[model samples]
Target: MSAHRSLSWLFTLGLLATLPVAFAGGIRGTGDLGLVIERTTGSVRILETSGNRFLARVEGLGDLSHASVVYSRDQRYAYVFGRDGGLTRVDMLEARVDRRVVQAGNSIGGAISQDGSLVAVSNYEPGGVRVFDAATLEPVADLPATFGDGRRSKVVGLVDAPGNRFVFSLWEAGEIRVADLSDRANIVVTRYEGIGVNPYDALVTPDGRYYIAGLFGEPGLAVLDLWHPGEGVRRILSDYGPGDEPLPVYKMPHLEGWAVAGGRAFVPAVGAHELLVVDLESWDPVARIPLQGQPVFAIARPDGRHVWVNFALPDNDRVQVIDTESLAVVSELEPGPGVLHMEFEPRGEEVWLSVRDENRVLVYDTDSLAVLTELEAATPSGIFFTARAHRTGL
Candidate 1:
């Protein structure tokens, strides 16, 4: 071969090597990934959030009626908590289950430890919280929700704190308990009793300083200072209820839907058609925004400028968008019946909502309230994005 030709051939090979290689199917980053829970089918459909693309489906998980998921720090694994107390660890990259165990008779949800080393499940059947090794799904510890009378109370609102601790609420006992898993083998449990009557659900602040439990037996919220345990539990919004004859609560409100946006918290008002906007710094009531029906999930967009809320049974077909700046409902959308869950894209540009009765997941533009696209799902309920991996209180 001629020397000039040889030189040109070598240069061509070098240029080809510098170009990106396309993997089989497609290459997806963590930011482009998400999961939609197929509740009745006991399966999860992986999605490409950027384009509303359905990637794959993983099945065989049991009783996912009220399911919740948390991701690993790297966003590679998903820990799915099922109502039947099934804890399944799914490999996001591989789109398969890595490990699973039926840890209890019934479980409400779960949380992954901050360090990504532990996964905790909040149970209702046997009534307690169980911690498992993140990688192996091996049992680490079990803390039963036992009251002073020795009766087991249902556990709820389990969240992971910064200091290797898991905080949760006891339903029957109406207490908040913080379990220090710093030393996993020797778990240290701290209980704060009499916070309220029938604490249903709880959530930790983004800063990991406050743990707030929503009361079911009363018209108030139980707040605890994780940073200052000695300060004790305080009840806020005690007078937010209408009167002695409160409206019937068809569905229990979820605090996980409570959103912290722009130094304020948007909480769902139980047994009412309103949202209680509270000043996070002062823990004071700021405003009450009336809604279409009983609010289920009042989730805020990542930008903190808007919050999207879904409703309970009779009003479950519609969703309301709340403008944080004005504290008012700016837009209302009826995606379909049985709107179960909504998850915003990491950048707040789009939102993915599961319409269970319609058997579809709809993606919408956050600003225009326009439907971007839709994907079919089976009994879909919760839409979880991989971006939650970096957030403190997932």
Candidate 2:
């Protein structure tokens, strides 16, 4: 070959080596990515919130009618829990399901441990909690919800606590249990019975110090202080039930939706059109603000300046925003029908809401209360952002 041709070939080879590095930089980060669950389609739509655009749709996730998601600490992977017991680990960066396994017959939801090394699922069919290795989706331990009569009770409200412990509630047995998984070889399980009748759902305070369970068979709430587990569980708001002739409940209230702002907790009242405000110091009722219908979710913005609430059935089309300082509803918006869920941006400047009936997700400006963007979706139910990876109970 000529000397000129040899030099040109070497130059082309050098350029090829630099091309891969340049292309890798274009790959987006998972911090700005999120997932929207499509209940009817059994799929999830991966989204890029920075540009407010749809990225990809991952299908074949079984029975997402009651799906919930928890993110890995790196924010690159999302663990999706489907109602059909399908536990899927999704790679947000790749926009695909990385690994999946069906661990039980029916699963309610799950949580990622504080260290993000384990994922635990609460089941209703077999009545037990299953813990899995976060990276490989392999079973690590199984703790059954067996009660007095040698029968397994349905589990609910499974949440991850600070010390790599898992806290959950027993629906049928009216009990709360804590499973300490810090040491795999020596697992410790603690049970607190007679917590409340039909403890429907629960939530751990952002500080991870308190685990509060909302009772369904009655009106009160069950509170447990993780800092002092020896005190057992105590009842709060026992006499706060709506008196005789209470309205029919359209849907159960989500305890995870409880908003803790300004030393108080704002929660939806079941079987009533009201939002109850509780003083966190005393865990007593401070005030009750009337609403449009049976309340479902009462969520607060990141700054805690305002709270956004949605209803069920007849009032499902409306969303009300309450001013935290005054503890009153300042704005009411009719954002179409079937408003299923709401998620605030990491900075609390914008919020995303899933309008299932309209098949769209609406993003609203927190300051102006105006619609900023509306993207098409397929029966979207839950809008989970990767920011949840850093939070304690989310």
Candidate 3:
């Protein structure tokens, strides 16, 4: 071959290699994508935040009245857990359900394993946790939350922990169980008794070091050090409840929205209009910032500069932002009625909220607190983003 001809052939191969990257540059990945659940219709709308537009609307999801979602490691698929025990695997790119199964009578929520190889659901009716293969949606193990003379307890606070393990709380049993699945063939579960009564929900720290369960039957929270599991569970904020007769709780606070900013944890006070701030170093209550109503979700920005909180009924229409450093309500907004949930952008530039009563989803600029966009939906609730796939607990 001629020297010039050989040089031209080499240049052609280099251009071909660059073509794929150039083409991909025009296509946005799933990182900028998210979904909003239409609770009334049992459907979800795939949203792309970069353009503030809806990509597709998928329907026929069962019983999303209290639905929650978790994403695969690649963020290409989402596992939706519904109230009617329906586990639906959704393909975000195709905007369709990849797989669906009714695994139990009733299920609260679910989590993906740390390694993203397994998905686990916590059931309320049958009272157990079921682990499934993430890729195939096939059952890998069945863990019944049985305790005290064959009574099955409802499982709550299901979270993926480090080391390919699952940690959950047993409602009726008043216990916490850590299921180790490091070896698929041999599953080991360590159980802790007396982990606080009626542990409704729980959260794990970002570092995957602590698992805390919020108690409904008591005033305090139950904390377990995953690093020191043999140390068992300890009680925190045991006397944080009200001194006088507490007001009626409109809705149970979601601990999944617990925020840790600047080494402090901001959590909702049960049955009270307050945001309890705790020193993460000591796991002790530092201060309680009074709120407008019972706080439902107290979430922090990614930068830890601020916390945005939504309240329960009668105050549900309002959202208050708290300055993490100042420890005060910085700003407030009334997006609409029935503000079910809030999700921040991956970098915390914007926040998306589901307004059920108005049948809309509102996006707001975090810095300016201005309405960026409004989307139409039936009755949206949980707003989940692909960013959660990288977080420890959602």
Cα RMSD of all models vs. native, in order, equals 5.3, 4.1, 6.0
lDDT of 2 at 98: 88
Q: For residues 292-379, could you state the per-residue lDDT of candidate 1 as single tens digits?
A: 9999888999889999999997999999999999998999999989998899998889999999988998999998888999888998
Give me the overall lDDT of model 3. Answer: 0.90
Task: Give per-residue lDDT, candidate 3, residue 93.
Answer: 73
Maximum-lDDT candidate: 3
The 10-residue segment of model 1 with minimum total lDDT is 17-26
- Reference-based TM-score, model 1: 0.93
Q: Each model's C-alpha lDDT?
A: 0.87, 0.89, 0.90
Residue pairs whose backbone atoms clash in candidate 3: none
Predicted structure with the largest TM-score when compared to the true one:
2
For candidate 2, give the lDDT.
0.89
Off by over 4 Å in 1: 1-23
Q: Per-residue lDDT of 85-160 in model 3, one digit per residue for the tens?
A: 9999998876778899899999999999999999999999899999999999999999999999999999999999
Residue 73 of model 1 has an lDDT of 86
